[model samples]
Target: MRILIVSWEYPPVVVGGLGRHVHHLATELAAQGHDIVMLTRRPTGTDAVSHPTTDTRVDGVRIIATAEDPPEFEFGRDMMAWTLAMGHSFVRTGLRVLAGERNTPEQQPWVPDVVHAHDWLVAHPAIALAEFFDVPLVSTIHATEAGRHSGWVSGPTNRQVHSVEWWLATESDSLITCSASMRDEVTRLFGPDLPDVSVIHNGIDIRTWPFAPRPVRSGPPELLFAGRLEYEKGVQDLLAALPRIRRTHPGTTLTVAGTGTQQEWLVEQTRRHRVTKAVRFLGAVDHQGLVGLMHRCAAIVLPSRYEPFGIVALEAAATGAPLVVSTAGGLGEAVTDTTTGLTFDPGDVAGIATAVRAALGDSAAAATRAARARDRLTEEFSWSEVAERTAGVYLAAKRRVRHPVGRPSIPERPLPERDPGQSD
Candidate 1:
C-alpha cells in the first residue's frame, strides 16, 4: 500500500503526542513493506522560499516537510492562518511528488492508495489531496477542540477549529480515535451520518524505552508527574495533594516534569501549600531523561481532568513505574484500578493522595502491578499491533471507496477491553 500522511507535527519538531504517534505508525507501516510519505510542517528558521519542501528518510519512511511558519496573533487566529498555509504547501508539494519531480530512480512517482491525516491542522490538505488524486481519505482525530475546552467552544478561533474538525469528520471515508471515549465524543459531535469511527488505543514501543534497574529506595521515595502543567492536565490537583501525601509519608519528594502555561501558577500554589521545598519542577526532560525518571520514581502520577487517552500512563507502565491516574475520560480505561495501577476521581485531591500513599507504602504489590502493566503493554499496546489495525482501517476505506453500493458498514468495534493475560 502507498500511504500519504499529512500532519502538522513530526520528529525534532514535536509539540505533543501526535508527532510521536505519526512517526512510529509511519515507520512501522514502511517496515511492513508499504510505501509511506509524510507531509508535515518545517521546523522554525528553515528558509521557506529557498527550501519550500525538505525531504528526508527516517527508519525507511520518507518525510517531506513543507515550510509553513506559524503566524503571530492573539487567540487561535494564528492557527487558522497556519492551517491555511500548511494546506496550500501540502497540496503544492504533493503535486510535485505525484509528478515524479521529487522522486529518485529507485522510488518512482506513485499515487497514494490512501491519504491518512492526523487532526484538523492538516485536514484541508488531506481533503484536497484525496479529492485531487481520487483516493480514499482516512482521518485520525487525536483530540478535539471541544474536548480540550471541556465542551465549551469559546471565541472565533475555537469555533473555527471546531468547524474544521466537523468538516474533516464529514469529508473523510473512515475515522480513527485513540479511545472509546473519544469515539463517542466524535459521534456526538458529528452525528450518526459520520463515517465509521474505529477505536485504536495509542501504543508505545517498549524496546525504545529501555528500563533502568533501580534498587529499593532506602531514603525518601520520589513521585513523578509528567505532562503539560495545565489545569486540564490536573497537575494542580497533584500539587494540592502533596501536603496530604507528605503527612503520611514524610520527606517524600515530588518531581513535576513538562512545561506549559500553568507553570507559574503551579509554582505559586506549591508555595501557598508550603510544600515548595518538597517539589522539584524539572520543566521539560528529554526522552532518555524521562525514561530514567520513570525507572527511578517510586510511582508515576497522572492527574488529568480530561485525557482522551493517557499515553504517559503507557510510557510509565512500560518502564515498570507504578501508576496512579485519575478516572477521567479514557484514563480509567487505560489503568485497571488495583490491577495495573490505581485510579482516583479527577480533581479529588484526597483520593490522589490516598492512591499515591497506597502505591508507595506497598512497594511489592506496586512492583507486581507495574510488571503486569508492562507485560500488558507488550501484549496489547505494541506498535506492531497498532500498525496492523491501522492498516486494516486503510484497506476497509479503500474497499468502501471502490465499492460504494452494497458495501458493508464499517463496524463500531472498540479496542479489546484491557486484559492482563492478552498476548501480543
Candidate 2:
C-alpha cells in the first residue's frame, strides 16, 4: 500500500508526543512493506534557496519537509498563516507526486492509496489532497482544543482551532483517536455526522530506553514528574500535595522535567507552599537524561487534569518505574490502579500525597508493580502492533470509500501474544 502522512511536526522539529507517534508509525509501516511518504514542517537552519523542500529517508520511510518559515506575530494569527502556508506546500507536493514526474520509467507514479493526517494543524492540506485525488482520508485526533480548555472556548484562537478540529473530524473518511476517552470527546463535539472512530493506543519502543537496575535509595526519596509544566498537567496540584507528602515521608524531594508557560507560576507555588527547598525544576531533559532520571527516581507521577493518552506513562512503565497517575481522560485506561501502578483523582492533593507516600515506602511492592507494568508494555502497547492496527484502519477507510452502502464495521483487532524469551 502507498500511504501519505501529513503532520505539522516531525523529527528534530517536535513539540510533543505527536511527532514521535508519526515517526514510529510511518517507519514501522514502511518496514511492513508499505510505501510511506511523510509530509511535515521544515526545521530551522535549512537553506530554503538550495532546498525549498527537503526529502530524506529513515528506516525505509521517506520524509518530506516543505513548510516555509513561520511568521513573527500574534499567536493566533501566526498559526492561521502557518496553516495556510503548509496547505499551499502540500498542494504543490501533492500535484508533483500525482503527476508521476518524479518517478522513474520502471517505478509507478507516487500516488497514495490513502492520506492520513495527524491533528488539526494539517487538516486543510489533508482534506484538499484527498478531494483532489479522490482517495480515502484518515485523521488521528491526538487531543482537542475544547478538552484542553475544559470545554470552554475562551478566545478567537481557541474558537478557530476548535472549528478546525470539528471540520477535520466530520470530513475524514475514518477518524482515529489515541484512546476511547478521546473518541467519546470527538463524538460529543462533532455530533452524529462524524465518521466511524477507531481507538489505537500510542506505543513505545521499550528496548531503546536505557533502564539500569534501580538501586535501593537510603536518602530522601526522589519523585520525578516529566511533562509540560502547565495547569492542565496538574503540576501545581503536585506542588500542593508536597507539604503533606513531606509530613509522611520527611525530606522527600520532587524533580520536575519539562518546560511550559506555567514554569514561573509553578516556581511561585513552591515558595508559597514553603516547599521550595524540596523541589528541583529541571526545565527540559533529552531522552537519555529522562531515562536516567526515570531509573533513579523512586516513582514517576503524571498528574494531568486532561490527558488524551498518557504516552509518558508508557515511557515510565517501560523503565520499570513505579507510577502514580491521575484518573483523568485516558490515563485511567492506561494504568491499572493497584495492579500495575497506583491512581489518584486529578487535582486531589490528598490523593496525590497518599499515592506518593505508598510508592516511596513500599520498595518491594513498587518494584513488583513496575515489573508488571513493563510486561504489559510488551503485551499490549508495542509499536509493531500499533502500526498493524493503524494499517487496518486505513484498509477499512479505503473499503468504506469504495463501497458507501452496506459498509461493514471494522472489528477491533485482538492483542498479539508476546514471547516470554523475546526482548522488546
Candidate 3:
C-alpha cells in the first residue's frame, strides 16, 4: 500500500500526543513493507524563501516538511489565515511531488493508494489532494473543538474550527478515531450520515522508552504529571489533591513536565492551594527526562477530564510507573481499575488523593500493579497491532465511493449558514 499521511505536526515539533501518534504510525507502516509519505510543516518563522520544502527519510518513511509562507502568520493568534496559508502550501507541494518536479534517480515520483489526514487543521489540503488524485480520503478525528469546549462552541474561532471539523468528517470516505469513546463522540457530533466509523486505539512501542527501575529513590516521594497544563488535562485537579495526599504521606511532592495556555493559571493555583512548596513545575521536559521521572516517581498520574485516548498513560505504564488515572473518556478503557493500576473518576480530587495515597502507602501492591501494567503494554498497545488495524481501515476506505470535495451539501450548525447574497 502507498499511503500519504498529512498532519500539522510531527516529531521534533510535538505539541501533544497527536504528533507522537502520527510519527509512530508512519514509521510502523513503512516498516511493514508499505510506502509511506508524510506531509508536515516546519516550525513557525522558518525561511520559506530559501527552502520551501525539505525531503528527508527516516526509518523507511519519506517525509516532506514544508516551510510556512512568508508575511509571517502565528498559529493560534492567526488561526484561520494561517490555516489557509498552510493549505495553499500543501497543495503546491503535493502537486510538485506528483508531477515529478524534484525527481532524481534515487527518488522517483509516487502516487498514494490512499490519503490519510490526521486532523481538521490539514482538512482543506487533504480533501483537495484526495479529490485531485481520485484516491480515497480517510480522516482521523483526534479531537473536536466542541469536545474541547465541553459541547459548547463558545466563540467565533471555536465555531469556525467546529465547522471545519464537520466539513472534514463529511468529506472523507471513512472516519477513524483513537478510541471507542472518541468514535461515539464523532458519531454524536458529526451525526446521522457518516461513512463507517472505526475505533483504532492508540499504540505505544515500549522498546523506545527504555528504563532501569530506580534502586534507591532520590529526594521526596514524587508524583509525575506529564501532559499539557490545560483545563481538560485535569492538572489543576491534581494540584487540589496534593494537600490531602501529603496529609497521609508527608512530604509527598508533584513534578509537572509540560506547558500550555494554563501554565500561568496553574502556577497561581498551586499558591492558592497552599501546596506551592511541595509542587515543582518543570515546564516541558524532553522524552528521556520524562521517562526518567516516570521510573523515579512513586506514581504516574494522568487526571484527564476529556482524554480522547491518553497515550501518555501507555508511556508511563511502559516505564513500570504505577498508574493512577481518572476513568474519563478512553482513560477508562486504557487503565483497568485495580488490575493494571488504580483508577478514579474525573474531577474527583478526593479519588485522586486516595489513589495516590494507596500507591504510595502500599509499596508491594503498587509495584505489582505497575508490573501488570507494563506486561499489558506488549499484548494490547503495541504499534504493530495499531498499524495493522489502520491498514485494514485503508483497505475498507478504498472500497467505498469517495465523497465530492466542496462546501458540504448538508446543513451547518452551531452557527447557522448565512445567506449567500444577503449582506449582514
Instruction: Pick the TM-score winner.
Output: 3
Q: What TM-score does each of the candidates earn?
A: 0.90, 0.91, 0.92
Clashes (candidate 2): 0
What C-alpha lDDT values do all the predictions have? Answer: 0.84, 0.83, 0.85
What's the best-to-worst order under TM-score?
Answer: 3, 2, 1
Which stretches of model 2 miss by more than 4 angstroms? 44-47, 67-77, 97-100, 103-108, 399-424
lDDT per residue as tens, model 1, 335-401: 9999999999998999999999999889989998988888888888988899999999999995244
**In model 1, how large is the Cα lDDT of residue 43?**
64
Per-residue lDDT of candidate 2, residues 206-235 (tens digit):
987755556879799999999987677998
Q: Largest lDDT belongs to which candidate?
A: 3
Structure candidate 2, residue pairs in collision = none
Question: Against the correct fold, how does model 3 do in TM-score?
Answer: 0.92
- The 10-residue segment of model 2 with minimum total lDDT is 415-424
Residue-wise C-alpha lDDT for candidate 3, range 316-335, written one tens digit per residue: 88888889999988899999
lDDT of 2 at 349: 91
